[model samples]
Structure formats: structure tokens, C-alpha cells
Target: MAMKAIDPQYTADTKYALEVRNVDIYYSAFRAVKNCSFGMERNKITALIGPSGCGKSTVLRSLNRMNDLIAGARTEGEVLYRGQNLYDPDIDAVQVRRSIGMVFQKANPFPKSIYDNIAYGPRVNGWKGSKAEMDELVERALRGAVLWDEVKDDLKKSGLAISGGQQQRLCIARALAVEPEVILMDEPCSALDPISTLKIEELMFELRQRYSIVIVTHNMQQAARASDNTVFFLMDKEDRAGQIVEYGPTEQIFQSPKDERTEQYISGRFG
Candidate 1:
């Protein structure tokens, strides 16, 4: 079957890449995230930071309908992309995922060769390119992730044979292979070493020039260091649902939070 195109309302004039409105997410009867509203600017990196189990990841997954994969998981309200609601009935979840790619907390490269790892997404999406074109595409994605130089000499090697950092980069290159407009990362550096984390942070800056990025991170320092904007979430004690405490430019969020809860969280006083 032919894939559905995004609604024609997608004009170049839209200011934000994504506008999340009054979004609430639930797993079965439990509300995980409540009333999230924020605009992710074009070609910028936005960080979602909060303590664990506060629904930061839940909200991140909803942006691309990843939550739908979980049984009994659902989302209410809208996630707008180019003026069209992604949750609309006619919207294609597969296409939504293609347009908005994801990189999880741990690097998970397919057990295939390095070249095949990068080529997999495009191939799955029905790439009709010739062998030479596929090679070029693989090279482009690997270079984009800054992994080309290290792995170029061994494209046939198994992706798992690489170092953990290299495996993460390979996973990133795999995501880049499909040329997504928005990239959602969930604690992408949590398992990496400091050097690997630094490399990923640098890659995020480079990628921000071409793609909109939203990352869910537990590392406050990483959020402050790498993101253009920050959204802080906290669990509502009574309801046990996560709620946004503040959303603003990274500098402002780190230096001077507006909400006392945000201030307390950032200052290490409480979760």
C-alpha cells in the first residue's frame, strides 16, 4: 500500500516544528503525563528533564505515537506538526514515525553489518536506489553521525562488534539514514562513558542545524549543556501523574526557573 503524505496544510511558514497542546498520556487506567503544552522550535534541541518515573519518557514517546505500541497506552489532546494534528484519524502512524525518528537510552544496532545497519531503514521504507546510491546514502548517514572515519574501513563488520560508543553512533547513523525532520532521543547517553557522552552532545549540536531534536534526560548538566530549550517535569504526588513545571530557554531554566518546584528540582533540593 502507498504511504499517506502529511496533510497539505504543512506550509513552510509554520514557526514551530511541533506544537504539543494539552497532551495527556495514559497507560491503562493510570495517567502518566498530564496537560503538556509546549512548542519545539525548528532546527533546535529541546530537552525534557526530570527525575525517573515522572513521565518525561512517556511524553517524549507520544510525540511520534510510540506510546501506541504499548498495550492499553493512549494519548489525549494534540501533537501538531505543520498545522495538522498527528493524532487525527487519517494520520498514518508509520509515516509519523518516519518523519519523527527515535533513539533510545541504550544503543541498539541491528545484528547486521555496519553498512546494512544504516541501509535498513531506507530499505524497509522501499528504497529503490541502485547499489552505488545505497553506498552513498550509507556513507552520508555515517558521516552525519561522525562515525564514517572510524568504521569506513570495515563496512562489512557486524554492528555489534564495535565499541559501545561506536554502536550508539551507528544507531544514530541508522536513524539519519531515513532523513527524518525531527529526532526524539530518550536518555541517549545514560549508558555511555563521559567521552562518548561528550561526542553525542557534540553530534546533537551539529544535527540541530538540520533537524529538530527533543531529548529526555535525567542528567541536568547534560540538559543545561546541550539543549536550546528545557522542559522540566515533576510527578504530582496526589494524582501520581507527571506535570510540566516549567518550559523556557535553557539558560533561563537553569539560571532562573520561574516555578518554585522547578527551582527546587534544579537546585538539588528535591525531586
Candidate 2:
């Protein structure tokens, strides 16, 4: 399906799930990404693609303030969600992260039982429900990630005992358990086999119906196939900071990119 054109400017009436305006990320003195701007539409999947050292992951991490965990990592400029600046002094980073959950490049499920893994987030966030209600919530989250049928009977098994793909899905389920409005995936399928990667792509489609998704991926084909919109980033040779080269509907970005650099990169001529 064709995606609507995104206006870089945000207004009170705009329908963007998240609007990143002039965002610059730095690790201490080195600016890693500069002046990045884009809007991720509600219920659509947006992919961030670039070669190595282009700050794709850095941009993704900033969406939920995950960068805050790294020493000396800081972000300047505004990331607006629901018309509020997420970087405001009054904003709570923990709540921001809860509302915009993340899945890492590698699946790092806690070393706990599958049930506990899915239940952990809600519990920490003050779940006041009976056992049956918690069970229902867990089931719903697992079903949302397309992993319910595969592991329904093994809820007591160690999360680490599952296959790599199942572990990834379990991690996704854990994120869903928190009922986030947006999901950020940083190469969630990078370590999976082809079939597992396809499963992850399919799960992404299902999840997009309810939550906005932003993914950072190096796989061009995956970006072309799975995303409604695409943002391409490249390093600025002058200062070695990453910046957006192009962003638009996936079809146009892949078929007729306006920038020659975009075309060259997409066609594998150069990074």
C-alpha cells in the first residue's frame, strides 16, 4: 500500500506517532547523528537503513531514551510524541521507555521462566490483578507476538532454553506485555536464520496494526519488503556524523530515489 506523504513540520493537528525534529545525538564530544528529522506514522512500519557507522542504531536508541543508559551519550533537539517533547526536563525516562518499548539486535530474555519473562514488566509497573487475569494478559501478549501456539504449554520453561527465534519472540512478547504504543526494534532479526527472519517480518506486519514500529536494519530487501516508509542515512564525510539522505514511501525510495547517493546505495554500488 502507498503511504501518505509525511510533512517534516509538526503541528497540533498532525497525526504522526513520533516526530523527530533536528535531532542530534552525541557520545561526549563526538556527534554521531546530526539534524535527523522524520515522522513515523501511526500503525505503520518505518525502517531506518544505512551502512555501518551511519548511526542507524543510534537514532533508534534515542527514540525511547535508551541512549541515556550509555555513559556520555546525549541527545539534543526535540523528539515529539503526542505533541510533547520527550526530552523535556519534567519527562520521566522510565515512562518514556515504557510507552516506547525496545527490542535489541540480540534477543536477551531474562534468565527466568517464560511466564515470568512475559509477566515481569507489568509486575514492575504495578499490576494489580488476580492470577487468572495475569494469565490472560500473558496469553494475549504471547498471541500478539505469534508465539502463543508454539509455547503455550511451556510457560514454565526457562526463557533461555528456547531456540534463538523463539527467544526473540519471547522478548517481543515481553515488550508487548507492557502495552507500549510504539515498538523500536534494533535489528531484531539480524541473528536469526532465513525462516526465522521471515517470521519476524510477518510478526512485524501483525504488530503494526496496533502499534507504530520503527526498525533499524542493514538488510535492504527486508526494508523494501516489510516497511511502509523508509529513511536512509549516510555519514557526512566532513564531520563523520550520520544524517538522513532520503525518506519517503518505500516504493518510491526503492524505485526512483531523488538523490543519486540513495540510488547508488540501494543498488549496491557503494555504501
Candidate 3:
């Protein structure tokens, strides 16, 4: 039997770094995801896991209003940041994005030199500081991404000149440079080698101390190993809209899921 939609719990008693409440995402009249709600704990990593086209990425993008860039994309209900609705007409999407930065599935670095790439966000956001201060900030951002030691001597090199893994880390560094409160990653490790993936996972653990994280991933083991909380999404043939079936602490979601569909998917019986 298929599972019904999870109730939209406000969870007002516990403070959340970010909250998606009773949201329905759509492209034109076609709904992609239906009535999703969850709260992200501060300084914790939350992973959204589901099959392809099940709207895990769609939900992730909605956190910062990234979906607004798409043609005909719209959302119903609220996506709250620090208890404020992001979709409120008074809110600026650019400001929202600045507060909650994103790293894509693929490594996308600018055509500029590595140093400039790291400094770009601060410059665009108007950092009122001296050259020395900007330089220190760049170095700090790179070091936070665990890439400073490797690229410090070659600051002038194009960000694209690096290997794939290094490029991905550079993107992470670039996102960090903005000093955002929450970082949304869309399958960040999907394109990396095993070693690179491990390094990224480890970096995530360290990053959670300073920033909240929400990641969309198809890798079950990655979600189980890297996330503090996990959300499971599924779509049935009768209704194409992706629905979140279960969500909870990572260990319980993996060890003993509340929904049979969640159990089946996590157990490798089906995706």
C-alpha cells in the first residue's frame, strides 16, 4: 500500500535553522512535489533521499528560492529562514540566496583565477574592508574548504584548471566565502571519486559547526553516514507528485523506518 502525505507540523517549540512548511512546488500547473514540511536543526546536516525525479532536488532548491529562476516555477506555502517566510512578497530573492548559498551537483567555478573566485562573493556583496582583510578572508574560506594548502601557491591559476575533485572543493570554498548561514548541496558527491567523496563527507562534518546543511542525495549510505536527519520521498504511478513518506533521525530512518515503503527502499529491495 502507498503512504499518505505526512502532516505539516509547525514545530514551533524547537527552533529550526530553516523550515519548509506545507509546501507544494509546481512548474506551471503541474505539481512536482506536494505538501512537504520539515524543520532543519541548527548546525546539523539534513539529507533528502529519493529516486530520480522524485523532487528531492526540487525541495532542496526551494530552500533558498533557487527554483524561482526556472520558467513557470512557483511554490505554495512557506519556506522559513530563521522563522521568517522566504516567499513573502517583501523578501528579496537575492538576499535570500545570499543568506542561504548553494553548491551544485557539478563543480561550477568561474573563468577567473582561483583567488578571484574565492573573493568574488565578498566583492559582489560589498565587503567594506582593506585589501589585507579581503586576502585573509579568501585564505580562510579556502582553508575552511580544506583546499588552501593545495592551491595557495597557485592563486593566479584559473579555478577551472584544477582536477574535478579540487574544482568541487573550490566551489564549496566559493560558497563559503559568502559567509552564508545555511548551505544547500544538490548531490554534491555524485560526480566525485571515492576518495574525493570521503573527503567531502568529512568536510561536511566539520562545516556543520559553523553552518547548517541540507543535501539531496541518491546514495543511501552517504545519507546514513553523513546526515543527522534523513527524509524519504516516493512517487507512485497514480500520482506523479513526489511525497515525503518518512523523516526522522538518520539512525532510526535507516535501522527501523516507520513506513514500509521507506524500509523497502533503504533495504535495497527497490529504489
**Best-fitting candidate, measured by TM-score?**
1
Tell me each candidate's TM-score: 0.97, 0.95, 0.94
Residue 41 Cα positional deviation in candidate 1, in Å, after optimal superposition = 0.7
Clashing pairs in 1: none
- List ranges where model 1 is wrong by over 4 Å: 1-4
- What's the C-alpha lDDT at position 113 in model 3? 99
Tens-digit lDDT string for candidate 1 (1-271): 5554786456767678998999999999999999999999999999999988899999999999999899999899999997778998778899899889999999999999999999999999999989999999999999999999999999999999999999998998999999999999999999999999999999999999999999999898999999999999999999999999899999999998889888888889876
Candidate 2, residues 1-271: lDDT per residue as tens digits? 3332222354567768998999999999999999999999999999999899999999999999999999999999999987888898777788788889999999999999999999999999999999999999999999999999999999999999999999999999999999998999999999999999999999999999999999999899999999999999999999999999999999999999999999999999997
The C-alpha stretches of model 2 lying farther than 4 A from their native spots are 1-12
lDDT, candidate 2, residue 98? 81
Model 1, CA-based lDDT: 0.93
Candidate 3 lDDT over residue span 1-271, tens digit each: 3432222353356668899999999999999999899988889999999888889999999999999999999999999875578898777788888889999999999999999999999999988899999899999999999999999999999999998899999999999999998999999999999999999999999999999999999899999999999999987567699989999999999999999999999999987
Q: Local distance difference test, per candidate?
A: 0.93, 0.94, 0.91
Give candidate 1's TM-score: 0.97
- Name the better of 1 and 3 by TM-score: 1
